[model samples]
Target: MKLTHWWPTALNPISNVAFLRPIDGGMKLAMLFQLAIAASAFSLHAIAAARPNIVLIYVDDLGFGDVSCNGAKAISTPNVDRLAARGLRFTDGHCTSATCTPSRYGMLTGEYPWRKKGTGVLPGDAGLIIEPGRATLASILQQSGYRTGVIGKWHLGLGDGTLNWNGKIAPGPLEIGFDECFLIPATGDRVPCVYVENHHVFGLDPNDPIQVDYKNPVGTEPTGREHPELLKMKLTHGHDFTIVNGISRIGYMSGGKSARWVDEDMADVITHRAVDFMERNQAQPFFLYFAYHDIHVPRVPHARFAGKSGMGPRGDAILEMDWCTGQVLDALERLQLTEKTLVIFTSDNGPVLDDGYVDDAVEKLGSHQPSGPYKGGKYSLYEGGTRVPFLVSWPGRIRAGESSALVCQIDFLASLGALTGTDLSQIKTAGDSQNVLPALLGESQIGRQELVEQGGGNQLALRSGNWKFLPAFAPKNAPAKARPLELFDLNQDPGETTNLASQYPERVNEMRQRLEQIQKNP
Candidate 1:
């Protein structure tokens, strides 16, 4: 179950998992026996040994220029910048999709999100999107002897259709590879705004069942559309539903008042549960997917962080996120897992302002560009919609530096396989996860040759080295494209301002041909 409160700094303790030992008699025999057992139990955990503790710090809707090291001059992200200071900071990292759901699907499954029929941004009450028997990154890591856990935003989907909130939420994260899950059903702007831990909603009163819907309202719960006066933050578009904590959400949820999560304490609540999971499983190597929900919609920063960023709710939420990162880093140090753990810092997609609420994101945006001078925000088919900050730090193995490696989030599974010394050939669907371990370790700059990028739905862009080609999507029911044919040399125009498809017809044709071949073949 999820924790009810945030851990105060005063209560946080230092870790004692030290390798330093003295030349004592009782300890000597114990050490020899322990070493023999460790050697026998596939314990390849020394330097250059088996897999390191993998922590994927996947933040939500964080922009490419959000960190201080990444041209975020308007706001500061010292904690994240410190991570960059200690590890390899990637300049050209991109997510598989421009939005949340599909990108997460690709990241976890190593398969293109569009391949699955209904894999788009899902409603909070939508049924499970993943096939029950599918193998995900978590399942793969599980087989590699890593205890897996996912904490925070799980917008993928929930129970297998006909979700009875009072019953077991099956076909959820547990069915996906996460040993345990402490998650939000969807975004903060969605309904049934409660923490689902493992199977049931934490703190849920069995007496108070939750009724949710997207089409019609629950018939009785007063909604934002009907009562605008109840709202604390006004919605500029969409997002006008049952109001909770004076914020209107996308879906309507009734009852379960005790179970509903407090938005103000969400970051802290999730962090405490994550650290607890780490502490509980510290004896063995574990994989923690610490998905932060900060910097998303309904940008309500905790009281302390409210005025921290001059850039309105967006900036304040980023400040909250930076603090969250610092807290997680502190957890690792306190647990004495700093040297043994490898933290991968990245985002699900690029940033977007006014996603749903009028939180002064656009008005208070100032000269601070969230997309870092890239061309798009949220749904655009441009570099800014996908290119984001990526960092890898493992106090010892990875040296401090910057890498221009053209890597995608989908490659993480394969890199972990190599790090754990696991046989990838034994795992199916992991074929899309190419081993970019060398790139991740700052050892090599060579990355995948071709990568498939999705905009909203079925909108595809093929990136081969420096040239990116956006072919006319011809599928009958595909999302409409604004441009017929577009091409750019990212090396020349990383902002994607100039289209070179007409200038370099031969390169365009070559890239189009290659894209079709990979799609048809893969």
Candidate 2:
């Protein structure tokens, strides 16, 4: 009997066995009935086992309107466009925070980064932020038998307090749940400036160990500040401390010459690792967080992509990132994993031009708007800072369309947990990660009822439907900046230019109390 048609036959097994007992009367009828039930159960198990592999393509500092599908016309992002066209593109999706570290923490842990202290942008040497053995995205998926890995840009920090760069690095990604990890310790503009595979630095020569210090400069390396003539890229501000590969960085490092990664080859290198992960785990259900460092600070595209975009290094880097995305897409197609995989493409935060670099991003920008119609960028408490492009595609599983649901990156833990049949309630501590799986699967238009967005300085904003409230709060240790309580009806004023707090005092009060209540909770 066919397995698809065996379920109904197996449901009435006793009756069939009884009916056939009088006629042909043998143990064969009973055996057939058992076979049907066994086949049906096995079929169901097989269907459940065929969980789609997940690939989350996380880009660093890509804005809402950075791709053509999101209204960017100056430069084309064909690969990103293909992913968007094949999936559900979100119009109102957002990252949990407007920066890398906090957004990553919230996205993986399912908790508000602000709920925990010391989640701000971390230096390359900072201790591990996600407490070990915590219920994390990787842990949950790993429990469900999915091979998990995070490749590129892990700004969540590494090791416990005093990390020796040459020694084994623990309590990092592997401790958190990932089976394999290849990381740039912090951001591209920060230091130690080396690629880390598992625990040790990738290419460290034992003869000349490695040393990192955030406070003072170390070794005899030339810096953009001390040796201006030796620099290939000019520093605008804070990133002039330690120089590696002709670019000054935030912290200081010495030795590990062979391990230092080239800025221009970053895209290609990370792409290769991501593809390798996919190919290696092609037969198993794997979860890959393929984070890209392209289009971030020190926008240095590979030589082949140089001058391709008329805008400048920024635009050229975007094109280079698009090509990297194409490489992954092609890999999936070649491996025949396209239909068997769920791919999500999104950015860590909004866009910013002239972010401590003189890359001509501000001067060469023409009619292109990075944040689309929203206001502010990166560090500001504005829609453009937190709101980003979010797309989810799973062939034959999720229908393709544009969704206006208010979704967030923080929901991924619960959402994916639900997908893989994990009992989330038992795990308990998944702070604020709601299972909006229906909305994520393109089955419902509804998403989160409310969300909290954090900007640069632990400053927070609340979103409820079309209304957004930004309650005035004094800065922690700094002098007051005379900021007023603000409100905006996002449906009417998508730009957030007009503050209607004076008009609707009651709504502001209600949202403020609700925001305070959330913040006050354990």
Candidate 3:
């Protein structure tokens, strides 16, 4: 009468119970109860296995019209197109902000970035912005038994205010919620041009320590401004500091020569690392935030992709990014994890040319429109600034279609929480996130009733239904002008050319009040 003797090895609890013979009625009752517990445990394990692995491929400066599926003729994104063909493509998807840092902040924290101070575009030497021990999206998933990791551009900063690059860097990705991270500390155009793997620089040498500064020059390295002949890529604006890999970056860095990354090989390196993470965690559900640094400034694409597009380095970088997406998709298919994994592809913000470098992105632009049919890009508070390509694929779970549901990246935390059946009540910081799992899964055609969009200088816009409201506000240090409130019925004027704020006074007042209420409450 040992229960172990009758325990099912293959979880055939009922079949195994047939072979059990009890010595007494009490023994029979105990054996049946134990068998039921074993069956229940097996069912729980099956449910856990059914939870889909999530991979969020966040790109940098990629526009709404960059992909072939979204009507781009100059560039071909076969991989991304394939994803859209097999999944849901969002026509009205957007990031929370026009800039990178704030959009990333809002997505991860599930709160409006403007509500918090110091969440603007950060310097290269900035400290970890997301406070440690806080409830982030990664932390929520991690608590729900998902292995979490972030690979590639982690512009969310690292360590405390006083960070020593040579020593162990704490309060980084590890402290926030991610179990592991391989990051490009800030942006590609910034310094400390080295990879940070978890707590230490990837390949640091003890002989040469690292020092980074944004205010002044730290090293005797020839800069783009000082030595123009040394540069492989010319500078157009402010990125004229310490040179690494023949290109000057935004900040100045002295040492860590051994760990400096080559811009051309970055896509390959990060893609391989992302594929490896998926392979290692194939047995259990995992969350991978594969943030790409491609299509950004200093657009030094690999030779394999060079001149492949007639649109120069910017177009070539788009192809390189597509290749990275293909690599991840291939890995999923090879591992037989495609059907069991949910993949989301999107950009941090809209596209921009001549950001900081002279990469022929403007001259060779030809007739291709990076932001598609929308007006304004990158820094403007227009449709093109925050609106970007968004695709979601979960194989058999999500049907292939297009949805114009008004979705924003800020809702990811609550949506994912709903998907994983996590208890969101315990996490009190997710004030701005809404659970739009049905919208995300193609079960619903409607999303957020109202969404806020932020642009350069913290300029805010409100989108309610088919109308967009842009309140007037002069930016810091700009010449004063009579800037009136602007409104557009997006269904009629997606370009936002017609300002109807005067025509509809009531609508303008209503949206203006709503925007103020969100700002005051949120």
CA-only RMSD, every prediction: 12.1, 10.0, 11.5
TM-score, each model?
Answer: 0.89, 0.90, 0.90
Lowest lDDT 10-residue stretch of candidate 3: 8-17
lDDT score at residue 116, model 2, on the 0-100 scale: 92
Residue lDDT tens for model 1, 174-251: 998889999988999999889899999888898888889888788477788888898988888888889998998887
Score each candidate by Cα lDDT: 0.82, 0.86, 0.87
Candidate 3 residue-wise lDDT, 1-522, digit = tens: 543334222111101112333343466777786887677446434434478899999999999988899999888999999999999999999999999999999999999899999999998778999999888889988988999999999888888878999999878999988999999999999998899999999999989999898888886887877888899988888888888999988988998999999999999999999999999999999999999999888899999999999898999999999999999999999999999999999999999999988888999999888999898888778999999999999889889999999898988888787677676766667788877666788966867778899988689999998999999876567647325689999999999999999999999999999999989985
For model 1, name the residue pairs that clash: 44-50
User: Which sequence of candidate numbers ranks them by lDDT, best first?
Assistant: 3, 2, 1
**Lowest lDDT 10-residue stretch of candidate 2:** 9-18
Off by over 4 Å in 3: 1-49, 480-483
How far does residue 349 in candidate 3 sit from its true spot (Å)?
A: 0.3
What C-alpha lDDT, on a 0 to 100 scale, does residue 457 get in candidate 3?
61
Question: Model 1: residues >4 Å from true position, as ranges?
Answer: 1-48, 473-481
